[model samples]
Target: MKNLLYFFLLTFTVVHAQDKPNILWITIEDTSPQFIGCYGNKDASTPVIDKLAEQGIRFTNAFSTGTVCSPSRSTIITGVPTFKMGTGNHRSNYPIPDFIHGFPDYLQQQGYYTSNNVKTDYNIANEKDFIKEAWNESSRTASWRGRSKEQPFFSVFNFAESHQSRTMSMSFDWYVKNVWNYLPEDDKIADDAFEMPPFYNDTPEMRKQFARVYNSIKLTDNRIGELLEKLDKDGLRDNTIIFFYADHGEGMPRGKTNGINLGYRVPFIVWFPEKYKHLSPWGEAGSVTDELISFEDLAPTMISLAGGKVPDYLNGRILIGENRSQPKDYLLLSSDRADNGPDLVRTITDGRFVYSRNFMPFMPEMRYIRYIEIADITKHMRSDFKLKKLNTLQEKIFKTRPHEVLYDVENDIWETNNLVYNSEYNAILKKMRNQLDTKVLQARDILFAPEYEIGLISKNQTPYLYRLDDAKYPFQDIYNVASLSGLKSKKTAKEQIKLLKSKNEIVRYWAAVGLMSQNKTTLESFKNKLMVALHDKYPPVAITVAAIVHENFKTEESTQLLKQYCKSDNMDLALMTINYLLYVDDKAPFIETIKKVHDMPNRNYNVKAGCMDFLGILNIVENTSKTEN
Candidate 1:
């Protein structure tokens, strides 16, 4: 019996050794395949990526489940669609400690030491479960060698170089300043050569803005080269299976952090020295397959390769080796919240066609601020509403979208042409719509249900109630309210006043947010309630109220409220006070607030930048007025 058991154990070990592969996933931020040479970009000089393609396989039609960082990463890590995980929106604050079972945890169970090099944007229940070793705080190169060699490992190295808001440190300013240097001068800076994507007008300034974006990409590619060189030098290249992909598309108008195909469709390349000879079912080295795959497939693929059992909760399928399945008939993508507002958009795409469902069809496709940031011409164009020579890209960015949209991707690579109304494509649209309906039903999407119950249940009362079924508004429920819906509603005003007096901190904060959106009498009532809320044990509520008052009101009362809160021990609240002061053009007061909070512990850099930016905007506005005078 002992001999028979030993033989069986040996056999099992041999099989497991053959099945497991060391996984090294390199996820880059804000990139698309269209810019890479392997994906047919003639201008991009991504030699490292092209070399990887020469060794492994390149996916022609890889898609991200969502466009934004959190949702896309969540979908990839959880191996589930964003809608299924109840995390389709960015504002759905991930409740920690649940451990929603990621691929890394599965691999750990299989005895692989899993580690991530920064970038844990997974809307996971508990971040600790996903990243057992907090290697993200350190450099990627150092993190790679931090692991033990005894255990075959799964390492994720995320490069942030491609991220938008390109830094001056990287010499990326050249791309923005010298757009004509890269492209031909004859290439009409304002003409059809620069295809103005739908929702954008055809303007010269918009064209110039796109040139800056292209420059940022160039800088990102340089960083990729550095990382790849480091991997080769560490002698990890031979055994490691390196897979490169982007979190989402470039943060440009219509694309970037939104849920358009331009936003979600990204570059994907895999390179494994041992497995390089064995072609993926799609093709051999440097071959690009037009298979429809989403980020959701990533987790399952990694799990399967690591010889780990794929979880039942995952909707993703493994797409490697003998088990490689054909691409799905359609891929689903969704976006809910990013920055300050809610944008609920759903997209279904086959290889040839794309169908979109804009839940908030009335809202303009592009945010005004984002548009101005990307295209300088947009800033000029906005000043003259009657200007008829609006660029196509500008038009696409500013225009209101229809409820449903259909595009022939085969012909319209830029997605400028909408074919939803064309009779010829009615059947195709109907088929895709039916597919979405069936999938949503199968997934048991809660959005389809008539009632969505929110709020808490306590020992005494049944808890608070907010019936979303009747609310009709899709995205507004998630924000601070003051940012979108101005202070105007009487009912919400009354509710805010009542809630500000609540014993619970959570309820009080939400109420304060509501109050920030009400009229004068309600505002006064809100202020009184805030005085009581400020004294409450909860620091966040006090800080939030102080910020709201400073942002909305410019009176002496608002200034006093801010001054009081700026003295709080909570650095976050103090920062908020400073930010609010900055927003209301009270620069002197803002500087004083900042000076007080300068030494406060745990002050967020982004908050500080927001304050600075606001100050800069004030100066710019002031200077422009002076020049005009």
Candidate 2:
């Protein structure tokens, strides 16, 4: 019996060694495949990436859940949608409980050495809440080299030389009035940018800036080459599964933080080394596949490669290894509050068509984040806007967005054309709308709340009440209110009033949204109730109350009432205060209140950045007036 047991243990160890492959993710930040030579950009100096593609399988249709780092990383970490995790806002960190561990924890349980060479900005409230057991080591010095020889590893390394911030000269780059690429002081870029996209004017400066970005890509590619060289020298190359991908798209104007293809589409290459080729679902070298994959899919793929079962809770699928599945028919995209203000956006794409729903259609897409304004691209875009050099198509992004947008992803990959208005595409529009609505409803997206409420819940470690079915605004309830708000019928005024008086704060907030949709005269009847709602505990409820005050009264008293929340210790409240105050009046008195917020310490980064930008724009306006005089 002892001999038999020993034989079984030896067999188990040998089989385990063969089945598990070391997964190494060489994560390059703030770049897209379009910027790489392998992805058809002749201007890019990306020999390493091109070589990786030659050795691996290249995926042309991979999408990221977000355009920015935090929200996208949150989804990647949790293997869940950003909204579902309640970490939807960029620069905000929401905690994950001990019991609910990330995929790395599962890998660690199976004795896999998990290491991350720094970059743990997972948008969690308590980053320490990260399960320590999930990683053998996670630091700048952490590497699979330190792991025991018998143990396979799952390691992630981030190269940020290509990040937008690195290309700039100063830490406060955005605060400067004029911004340009500070690296490679003497830029050697000629007047060319592959094919300048329609939005950009073909100018020497623009071409130079584009070339500077290519230079950064080249630097990042060389870094990748060095890392791969180290792997080959260690003689672990054949036993490893290598993945090269960007955090998101290139961080530039109309890309990066935006929820468009220019922002979300990323380069993905999976190298199943010759020794492990049979383990790969693709089972081939140097192939191109059109797979609709998202960052969420990475967690499950890693889990499967570690010889572990993918959990049902994870929305991702095993893209390779055992239990491998076909590519997704569609992938979802979501972006919310990239900076200080709110830009509630959700999208669904099936490789051919892309559809987006902008819940806050009243808000312009180019809200000019104070920090991001440091880029020269922003200065150029805004200058074009002021000079009226931009055509109607160019101005659309700066203006209030359409509630819904439909684009032919194949014909218009840049998403310039909105096919929603075309009667011929009505059926297609309906189908896309239904697909998006179903996704939102199915996820019970907590973004149904106002920005303040979303911000509030996101800041607090444990979620307020956002569960699949347990939230204050369940999927169907919010869906019903959403449908009703569109009608804006005077006949439903009484029903809305009842909702405003409901016990649930979410209900009252939606009720206010419905009331605000109506014409001022039609909504006048609720003046007293809105005033009472001003004293509501929740910021979302109070925001609606303030909106009503601005619409109905627009008085000094209302501004003062909103100002009370400026020092309320929450950036969201302060920014919302500024938003309301600015909407009502942008005079000296209101501007003072905004400055007061700028003066506050420990304020959220986005809010502080936003205030600075707003002040800068105001300064520009004031200077222009003086010049004219």
Off by over 4 Å in 2: 1-15, 129-131, 167-188, 191-193, 450-461, 469-471, 482-503, 511-537, 548-553, 579-588, 624-629
* Count of clashing residue pairs in every prediction: 22, 7
Error of 2 at 249 (Å): 2.3
lDDT of 1 at 495: 59
Please report how far candidate 2 places residue 452 from its true position, in Å: 4.6
- Model 2: per-residue Cα lDDT over 488-570, one tens digit each: 56777667777777777777777766665566676678677667777777776677677667656665655567667766676
Candidate 1 on 166-259: residue-level lDDT in tens? 4111233544453324434443233223344445544555555554544555555555677778878987666677788888876655676565
The estimated TM-scores of all candidates read 0.66, 0.87
Q: By how many angstroms RMSD does model 2 differ from the true structure?
A: 4.3
